[model samples]
Target: MDLAARKYNFIQELSSIDENLLEKLELFLKTNQKDWFDELSIEEQKEIEIGLKQADNNELMTHTEVMNKFKKWH
Candidate 1:
């Protein structure tokens, strides 16, 4: 589906995958988080740290929100 159409469809909260993709993502997160975190370099660590800081401050949005931001722009 077109990304722009996804955005205005939900002004209050961002959009998400249509259940099936999210199920795959949930399984991926469950199985791969350790391998993923372990492979990150110092720079990627710093970026995640920044994101965590923003999240701590309630200044960060969900991954879906970030995707919405870029998918619309791009």
Candidate 2:
């Protein structure tokens, strides 16, 4: 089938789905999109990249190490 025909068929099939399923589909479509990184500021993006580089270099702290440090303050 042509793209237009396939789109129409898809819409037709989608319309017959249950309301709750349709709502869940809409939520999934909204939340699963790829535009979240574009919403971050340049500085925030740089900070995330730096943290990722640290992780790549195995420079991150473990949960126990972080908790131990935190315990010293209390």
Candidate topping lDDT: 2
User: What is candidate 1's lDDT per residue for 1-74, written digit by digit as tens?
Assistant: 57787666754232455778668867987987677766899899899999899888999677998898899678
For this target, which candidate reaches the highest TM-score against the unseen true structure? 2
TM-score of each: 0.35, 0.53
Total backbone collisions, model 2:
0
For 12-74, candidate 2 gives per-residue lDDT tens digits of 999899999999999999998988778999999999999999999999999999999899788
RMSD from true fold, candidate 2: 10.9
Off by over 4 Å in 2: 1-34
Candidate 2 at 58: error in angstroms?
A: 0.5
Show the colliding residue pairs in model 2.
Answer: none
lDDT of each: 0.76, 0.94
